[model samples]
Target: MNKRILTALLLAAALVVSLVGCSSQTGGSKPVEDAKTQFKSEMKFYGSTTLAPVISQLSTSFNEHYVTWDKVDSKFDKKDIAIYVSGAGSSAGVKSIIDGVSDFGMVSRKVTDEEKAKIEGYQEFKLGMDALTISVNPKNQLTKLKDSLTTEEIKKIFAGEFKTWNDVDPSLPKTEIVVVTRDIGGGAHEVFQKAIMGDTKVRADVIQAPSMGALVTKIIENENAIGYASYGMVNQNKGKLVPFKVDGIESTSENILNGTYKVSRPLIVLRKGDMLPQEKAFMDYVVSDEGMDVIEKLGFVPNK
Candidate 1:
């Protein structure tokens, strides 16, 4: 072979090796870049009024921090990723997911067998715990009622057997007691019924509110009215509502954590079948240490 021709061939071979090396390095990183950019366009969460505020705050934090692909990039569009949180009731939340109306359903209680039957292979994620607090209007004259009522006495009062305040405690006034309760299908109502009423039905004469906020409003407006709500709701309305001790145990986070609060229930999110990557990511953030911190701040006992 000619010397010049051999040298040219060697140089071409060298250039081909360098090009292959460069391609291998860059091509290997393409998948990593794609993983970083992958995200859901939107996610919809509906259910449990009790879990709404906490999830809503989480949605905000997730959108602000986790949803971003590049935090330092000035052109990164945070609005492209969206999370919608709303609550009708736990039952509604579950139904919404079954009906294909939402990406997730939040419930403040364990999934009922009936609810489980609605969707094949549905899964529940326990995010936190919440104690149901009995509340009355702050102006009610039965001031000692909070400290004195036993579980049996509470059952009697809600059962309509004790029609007047004096019927439960002779020391109290004879004013007709106004019973308030959550409407059927609320997870809070389900938990309250199991924990407080047992086999006894809540009286048909009682006033039923559609949501925790509405129930709180009803209790606050009527001095003679009594109702139950999540501890978080009562805590936020402390001045307007008086939280009662259940079986002499105060509905505190510590009591819930220590297992002394009898009225407590699990807060959960439900999904049917396999979770999408975005849904799994959101759930991951919810159970993370940072997410548990958010749950604790909302007055619920963190699962972690």
Candidate 2:
């Protein structure tokens, strides 16, 4: 072999080896880039009006702080991903997931055995704890009832046994009792019925509102109205409605965390079968410390 030819061959071989080494290094980083791209899209969350605010805030924060790959380096762009949160009630939310209409469903109560039967291999992620508040118009003059109402008294009011405020207590004025309740399918309604009403039936003539917001509105508009709502909603409307003590226990975050609030329920997110990478990431963020901060800030008890 010629000396010049041998030297040229060695140099060419060295260049090819260097190129292969560079390719290996770049290929190793593909997974991280793929993960970023996989999640850079829209996410849909439905159900539980009580959790909608928290989901909305978390979605905003997640989009603002998280970076994604775009064929180059990581970059944070709000437009890269979008999260839409809506509340049609917990049952509807679960139905949305089973029907493939939503990526995630939010529920403020335990998943009933019947709901579980609707779909196979669904998973529940508990995000936080919430308490149902027995709310009344702030201007209500039932001072005795305002201070505290025993479980029996609450049951009586809803059962139509107590037709007037004076029937609850002699100290209270004689006025027609107005009861506001959530629609039958509402998680709040189910919880209220189980926890407070038990086997007792609510009066047939009682006014029923479709959503917590509407129930709150009805309570605020009628001085004699009493209804049950999530503590977060009642806390948000402190001046408009009074969250009365039940059986001498107030529905505060502390009480809920300590198990003293009997009306408390779990706030959960539901998904079917295995979770997509994006869904898992969002669920992880919701249980992370930063996510718990958002939960606590919205007036609910964080699971962690």
Candidate 3:
């Protein structure tokens, strides 16, 4: 064996080793680049404390079941979908969408024409129907005196015209009636205003609760309290409170679904401008049969 031939063979082996290393590096980098091309980014849905519980749970289930937002766009990335939900009230949710701060907005009432005009290409989705129930503590004297309230009487009670139980009815006690309400920013407040108050105003001294849950708790805590809440929340508290029939119509599922519950409002979601692939994907899921099932389970009348 010649020394030169042995050295040449060693050099050839070294060249092969270098080429193999380069191939391995290129192969390793390809998958990472491919992964980057297929990612779906996070989205934020803000608004409607009433709708928050439903949407939050739906988002959780969506993230769990759909690894990617492929239901709407097959070309979308294969990353897990993330929709962060928070409740700051319905008006706040609408403002967030208008300000480009949120991908979607949830509202428990219909969007007034004025609100829709502010956003370009504004779109809304109806999730369900929720009734606004006139609730009082089960122990309230009114429960013993009356099974129902006329719309006109409700208007007077909230207008501060009727200050005491005796004012509402002659036979009841004279204890001062406690008027409770959601803040003006809440969709529930607006619904109550339109449906029952008409041009009348809520009493200046009304107790304003921050959310439906808070309003229910306030009614439960105060025997003299009278206020409005979503029928769903009222049903959740069941025996703890009494929901008065409005104009002889109860807020039953049949009444709400049949449009006989005059105080009910639609649960809605809004998005402005062109729909993002992820946004459309989510919105579609929220109205699907499965999504409607979630609404029904949460005690609202599903739109379907």
Candidate 4:
């Protein structure tokens, strides 16, 4: 090959490579169903840990079927170079989006007015609905908590004021009561705290579990312990757990949707400001019919 011609050809190739990199934001691209190509880029998705199961499962299936990756390393083996997922809690998810650390965030509750102001062009799209369910060990005969606990009563329980099952009500056995709760930053935790304790903080004696699994385990193992979580989480282990009544109603889907459930909250995904093209496409997929089926099957209320 002539030296001059070779030099010009190398320049052209470099230009092409540069354009591809910029287009993908990552170093690779893969085809999807319907002959579409979703750019494999370093997109981080964060939010509700409750959503981790379904989203992680579905994202895996998506990658296998329609996306490919530029696998960087373990603990990060994303097939679709465009996106990766990370989350601690729903509140954390929303915070990450607000902080611009995540392309999207998952949440189990509506964005508070204060949160809305953080991102100038914020938009919230409903993925589904979930309920804040209070759970007790199967052995605890107390079926459910009151629809709302007086702030004083809540403080009494968490503060060790009401330390026995019989203390709350004489009909129950004399069992040492323990409170297992989520970290204050969790979205559902916030709801429960607000609803039951009002402005009061969880008492110093309250046991703070690291995650829902830990909280559930604490409740199940300790017959006297009680904890709260999204209804789906509680029900999946319902064989060993008993849900409580709030007021006069049980924590069934029917009650939650019909206004009988006082703690019903929307499960959502949020994009920062107005969504980008890719983010919008992903969001639309989540709200579509097939997407909704997963939500319902997983014990959530579809936005539909």
Candidate 5:
């Protein structure tokens, strides 16, 4: 074969070998407690909102196999894992851990100095990057938006100062915008406040949803609803939800990686920078190429 063809064949062979090696090395859900165990002790975990999807997958995969512990009742030798993920806001998760309510807390934004001081034996680690996406329902005809609205303008719209869509843009329809927002305790709330609302509280007329799932549901149901969600949650969507450009930049991995997505935030799995062997392994798995595969599929930007 020609040199070019020969190189391509060699590369293909190498890829196949690499894939096979990974397949054989990976042990899916068999008891790992007894085999080269790295954990000093078995443990359970609960995580926060922004980290919910990734953490849940990690927890489930971890739980499938025993980790340094035998099954309590080994008659059937059922899975003896204890990791559980509770979908709460980042603030709630941090508070829970600080108050001794959970094993760990997850947050997309950096923990504040005041918050850092509150957790006694706590620490945080960044997992990846995520962007906050602005969205509107499908039926709304207003398409063009300013590259980036001022923080004041964003607050005013949510606060009901700009009551109708046309109020902000006279060329748009006069439909009353039904603003949907995250619950008060949500991490999204924190980011939105700091990035776009300054310190102002959400307007009274804004509809608050308990979770991102609910927020999406409400937005989809109400053609007039305008809301925000993590790029991961809504990027895969089609026409039911329309994500607007932020400062003329699309919230894609490309834009985020290049530092153009203004709202991109890091996703962290907190457990102190130094991890126990098991924790280290789990964290590594998450940021690893395979782990990033999951993140990408979920519509979030992977860490550069």
Candidate 6:
């Protein structure tokens, strides 16, 4: 062979070897990532306005950390681990999962047996703890009269048996007690009814706020209003409202975690059948220490 031609052929061989080595190193995980993406690229969650904040924040963090979701499987090139979350209500959340419309349903209360039986493969993941905090407007005079109420008294007030502040206690005032609550289908409302009202029904005339934030605002805006809301929601709005003690126990984190508080419930996620790879990755992250940090930061008690 000519000397120049031989040198050119040698250079070409070296280039081929280098290219092969590079491909082997980088392309190893490509097939795995592609397989993972086929299982799921985007995840959707709906239900529980109360749990929405936690999921929404977690989704943002998940997207940032898992540009390639190596948590559930081998890393691949950037797959859009798009996590979509919405909060309609807890009942709506359960229905969404059963109907196959949502990847997961966020529920702030326990799932009833009936709901569980409706689907073929119902699964739940408990994320954290929250309580129903009975709150009154900051300007309400009942706080001066008493900071705590017996379970019986609270029940009567919600049941419409105690129609006025004076009815609750003569020294309080003659003002008609305005009962406020989250509209039906909310986890907060269900928790409140089970813990306080029990067999008794809530007043027909009760003011129903559509969302936790709205319910908080209603309590703050109406001096005569008394309502129950998520402990985290009320805790976040501390100065804007006043939370009452139930049966003499304050709704503190320590009290809630210890089960000393009567009104608390679990924060949960629901899905049907097996989770896709992306769903598994997102859920794994959700229960991780970092995920628990998000729960704690939001004023809810982490299960850990």
RMSD to native for every prediction?
A: 10.8, 10.4, 7.1, 8.7, 19.7, 9.4
Q: Candidate 6 on 1-304: residue-level lDDT in tens?
A: 9999999999999999998778777884343346544545678999998999899999888777656555446753345667888989898999998898988999988899999998778888999899988888888888888899889999899989999999988788789999889986577888888888888899999999988878888888889999886788876886888888999999999999898999999999998999865678689889999999998888899889
Clashing pairs in 1: none
On lDDT, the leading prediction is 3
Instruction: Show where candidate 1 strays beyond 4 Å.
Output: 1-39, 66-79
Q: Give lDDT tens digits, candidate 5, residues 162-187.
A: 99988878888888889998886677
Give lDDT tens digits, candidate 2, residues 120-221: 678888888998888888788885345788889999998899999989888888899999987876888889999999999899898988777888899989
For candidate 2, the lDDT comes to: 0.83
TM-score of each: 0.79, 0.79, 0.82, 0.75, 0.74, 0.82
Assess candidate 5 and give its TM-score to the true structure. Answer: 0.74
Q: Give candidate 5 misplaced runs (Cα > 4 Å).
A: 1-42, 63-79, 144-153, 272-277
- Compose the digit string of candidate 4's lDDT tens values, residues 88-200: 88889878988998888878777888887897788777777788776778777665534444445555676677888788878888988888887776877887776666666
Residue-wise C-alpha lDDT for candidate 1, range 1-304, written one tens digit per residue: 9999999999999999998788778783343446546555678889988898889999899878755623413344444557899988888888997898898898888787887988866888898888878778878877654564688888988889999988977888899999988886577888888888889988879888877888889888899999886788877776888888888898888898787888888889988888866567678888999999998887778898
Superposed by TM-score, candidate 2 places the C-alpha of residue 40 at a distance from the truth, in angstroms, of 7.0
For lDDT, candidate 4 versus 5, the one ahead is 4
Give the poorly placed runs of model 4, Cα more than 4 Å off: 1-40, 69-82, 141-159
RMSD of 6: 9.4
> What overall lDDT goes with each candidate model?
0.82, 0.83, 0.87, 0.71, 0.70, 0.86
TM-score of 3: 0.82
Extract clashing residue pairs from model 3.
Answer: 38-77
